[model samples]
Target: MNDLPFLQHFIVLPVLLPLLAGALLIPVKQSRYSLKFACSVTSTILLWVLAAVLLAMADGGYWPDGIGVYLASNWAAPFGIALLVDRLTALMLLLTATIALAVLVFSARRWDRVGIQFHTLFQFLLMGLNGAFLTNDLFNLFVFFEVMLAASYGLVLHGYNLHRIRAGMQYIAINLVASFMFLIGVALIYAASGTLNLTDLGARVALLGNEDTWLLSIGVCVLGLAFLTKGAMWPLGFWLPGTYASASAPVAAMLVLMTKVGVYAVLRVWLAVFGNDAGALAGFGFTALTIGGMATLFFGAIGMLASQDGGRMAGYGAIISSGTLLAVIGQAGGPVLASGLYYLLGSTLAMAAFMLLVELTERIRPPGAALIAITMEAFAIEDKPEDPVGQGIPGTLAFLGLSFAACALVISGMPPLSGFVAKFSLFHALLEVSPTEGKVPGLTWGFIALVIVGGLAAIIALMRLGVRIFWASGDIAPPRLQFSEAAPVTALVALCVMLTLQAGTVFDYLDRTVAGLAQVTTYSERVLGEPPVMRSPQRGLER
Candidate 1:
């Protein structure tokens, strides 16, 4: 497949492939669940392969900026359709595909069979995620954002219940307001800066007058509000925990990736448009991002400590992950962003795997069981705990315990896992690069202190939860397991393990990625430099 002539066109395949598959699945009769499932699975597998190849291609450094720009309909940037990919984009593609495939398989056992609508929206949501990562145009990004959100609405409401319905409506309302702000911000941006193409905005923004710059800043702040809302910042993220907790397990897992998409947007826009190259606009929002991130991190840490609900607990874990990434991006210097990206990969995978496991654990611990388990864990019982050798442990229970521990270790940044590696690297980078390098570096101590505290909070919360699920629940029969359901969660956790083993190679790649992103001119030149795919019949038949 890599040898194929059109493989250079692979940049567009992630977006197109899912769109085509989803569209085709729409007409399949509801009774033909098997066929729909097969198509969805096939498309997802193909997407994974395609993503792997794309990541490899970027690693080859074929483009000077490590960015690949594809002009659609023979059009160019700021004028014609454009899609772009750099190492970051390719990495995002692979991450999306990896998680989507896992979640889809996890659904295959029962969730997919419960309804075919989920099957269709599943692929369409993939399409939206892929497009969002690949597209260079802000308008195109908005289109994909809506596409993703639209599918998410259905997914959140998939297994309708009062809790889900209520959460879905609030999710919709918050995002709709965000979308409205996105539009207003874009309009004001165009009025103030004259371009919506990211590269163009980077180049043109600094040239504006005082009035225009002020207007542009307002517009950018507005636009960023939408992303912050999506990114789940404090105050703006009031809707996230409820919405994520209410979605079906597989859908909730996908929402982990969904949350990162918001972070990705914030990362891209903040770097591309407000970098040191933007003159007066340079470093405009870094302080705000830092404050917001620290606040969100603290909020999430406390929320996790306070919440007993499994789903909401996972949601708060995601919030901590987001806060970490947001704080890193706000740093704007040092070698920390790579560490943040690394953390992003691990936390996203771990959180998703944990969310998937939540439903299975719930099967063993009913509402009353959870209450009982908590009581048993918090209060003392007579001696003679279970056999020290664990003689009576069921295989299913053992597997759950191991998987749950792995996820907890990773999410909490405990030792011997990728999450710890990420946090350690982050602290190392921060220490090496002083606060003077970043505006919010003044708050650098705060960030580091909170990160340590946050990790501690996660450890305590997860440890308590684990005891409740495994130890306190009275002797119970092992729940029935399906290969499809169990494999996905196991695979995701393994991926985090793999990340730990291969940290050096992955960090090198991300280091190269951050270096490429630092050179704003290269990205702009790559997008703006591509010659038209064809010219008017070689200039009217050469006269």
Candidate 2:
């Protein structure tokens, strides 16, 4: 085994480096070169840490130790702070890091235009993201969440506009409430289980029978609500669209990764501490997940239709996609697992591209506008009369159209796209559920609705917005697209293309990832006993 000291360094560096860099950036904010170099270096180092940790995991031959390295004091877990990395956590960490780097690069010009402080917030936000992914304790999770939220508050209001301030406040307030509930839920879980180490909680949960089950169930339900709110599930995600729409492009891109953290936590907590515990809580099962997922889908689709702004519409569509992924998890068996993970990958890539598009189109004038607004100080031109002969359609509009089309293909689950691959696995998994297994009735109908409505909503919404924004007779002119902005969006689209071209390879990787999920006993075995034998193949599958 690798030395514990080395692992501790790996576990802590990703979080600490960003915080240190962010603190250092505050003093040098006046230097543009320093700000740019600092953000780039911080992001690169974090990515390197992510790669190093994954490499270490591989070298160790996939250590399933539920509790990873402890703190400087080397205190025992549940009593001392520690970091944990499992397959799900690792996946999310890499996802956050990759997206973080992309967003930082996308924001280079915006940082130069606005202020260097945005990078400061971005780095701090990343610190929080990394902390959240790595922490083994629930309370630590809440702390990291607050760190992220604090950073987000500044970033959301970076432009210091009326709409942004209002949106940012609402977002912050809503999350604050969720944060409180999150802490309360953690306390309740700790009280009921007498430990906060997630791995230990799983073990304790397996020991608990029907005696204190009601309390356990309620605790899980409360925790689930907090996570769902973060995940942007229906009813609780009311603030997501408005806030995301109002935020700057780079900020919006980073925000998208936050929801995935919530989802990852939900999945981990659900499987670990409350796996199929029928006696624990009422209304806290796959059935609830299915119901919630469906509700989120309906609400998101409606919200998307109601939206006039393309950014807000895309935000709602993101919520809709999240709901679908969660719902598939509820129907978990085989294909559902495959679909949920695969769909997430697809959506992450697409959302990054769409966020860039939204930024590019936010300022373009109509077909007859005579000049461009150079900065917030130039906003007086909002009332300027257009030179009817001089204005022409903005090239940025064409870029938006292309981006929206790409998003449509992914979100709608069109063929030869990552989204399609994800949905196909999920729908097939649902269909493959044996009727004899006593599954809920009309499951297939639910899956059918998911594919049909999700596809239609994505397509119709994209078409409507594209036509109004890009081709309508009175549509606004597109904004200027800089190389910095265009490059990231193009690279993201290229990733989508690569995903499409290498569909088989992507699916295979997804299968491996899901397979990692299947080996839940691996963690427990490392802690308590020999690992359980996994069946080589399912009886339901034919040769």
Candidate 3:
């Protein structure tokens, strides 16, 4: 297929459109809610459409190695800013746009009115996310990261309640420290390698001497710490539940993708720069990642079991997903990485849907129900007052209940859903140990046990919470739910069902994505506009 003029510019639009729209929105009167909604929705829909087209083109083999590299301002890479789109990048963009559209639609129903500049902040957030996914330069990655963080600060504090304020403060402080570390890491990398372009850094990293290699490793480790913090891995993740639970539902749903940005960064930078082609630097942090990932999984599992609040349970679910991806990616094996990609998609969708459902379910709960339930349990009251036995469940309550159950199934990795398929694929990949690709020491068994236990923990947590929310409460009036509110949650859950039906096709695409990611040579050549000088031929994990 010939290169279309507009398609050539498609890569930039994801970042540019949102930025322009957000800036344009700043001057608009706050009273013009309809205009703001129209503009935000239009931009998000366009982004989704553009992302879909880009994904198709990249996956359909429109460019070399399924990569579409766009140099900003016609300047070449490693000197000028570059936007590189491959299958993985396109997939992230699509996820971001899809979720953004859903959350925006949900917010428009009423949540947008609670906060000033909600629409504008949302667009800026999209711009940041798209830029982070698309940028090939490290500095630009930092810029986009800050943009994302900045917008998140506003959204987190949206509605301005005491709980939101407290959570937002903690969120801001921790991330500010992370931002500092990120800047330090970027400076160290640039100082050592004389380049900030990811592919150029990848190429140059291969030729580093022992001293330079150690320095770069330090820098990478620092950078990894920052990503880990943002990804909410283990100890760094304590703040996520509170922050997420405090945000309004739409904002909380959108925040599901925030951790993914960190995961994507780790995957992109680690594979491209310190991959096997990095010679002595190969497998620099592999052990740490493996151990850390397992620990994260365990931590998230414990948190899930301990959490009484539904929002916090969903937060732990996100942590568990992040841990699973980290472990698989740490192994650096193609099949496992492919499986991780699938799990990433399924878990993210489930968590987003779960977040939305949390709000809807909570709305229907009787006032002071938690306190009342605690008192009843404390007193060992067996015969609580029961509502009329034959009363039919309200339509809204029934819908929320069904949606809540489906989300629980997905999050718990129950059978006959995408979550089950994802977990099964991951476990299968982990067990398929090959002679050429040795397993991480002590990782195989531990990871398997952790995954199973985590699933069980999630099941227990979700079921307990579900029973409390749905059955234990008595004679509660159903909250009025708008179709707009319910529609997005239903759509997200239905997408998970669709993912189950199309698992085979999705896995095939992921296989291709993993293959492309493993090709350090092709990635470097395409991004740097030159072949790397010190390419290594070794493959698979090194002992």
- Who wins the lDDT comparison? 1
Give a tens-digit lDDT track for model 2, residues 469-507: 566646464455556667678777777878778878767
User: Model 1: runs farther than 4 Å from truth?
Assistant: 1-5, 366-394, 435-442, 535-543
What overall lDDT goes with each candidate model?
0.87, 0.70, 0.85
Q: Write the per-residue lDDT of candidate 3 for residues 463-499, one digit (tens) a residue.
A: 9998988788887777776667778888998998998
| All models, RMSD in angstroms | 6.0, 7.9, 7.8
Tell me how many clashing residue pairs each candidate has. Answer: 0, 5, 0
Q: State, as a TM-score between 0 and 1, how close model 1 is to the true structure.
A: 0.92
Encode model 1's per-residue lDDT on 344-387: one tens digit a residue: 99999999999999987876775576568557555533221111
Candidates 1 and 2 compared: the better one by TM-score is 1
Comparing 2 and 3 on TM-score, the stronger one: 3
Worst 10 residues of 2 by lDDT: 381-390
Give stretches of model 3 more than 4 Å off: 1-3, 368-394, 434-441, 530-543
The prediction achieving the highest TM-score against the true structure is: 1
Residue pairs with clashing backbones, model 3: none
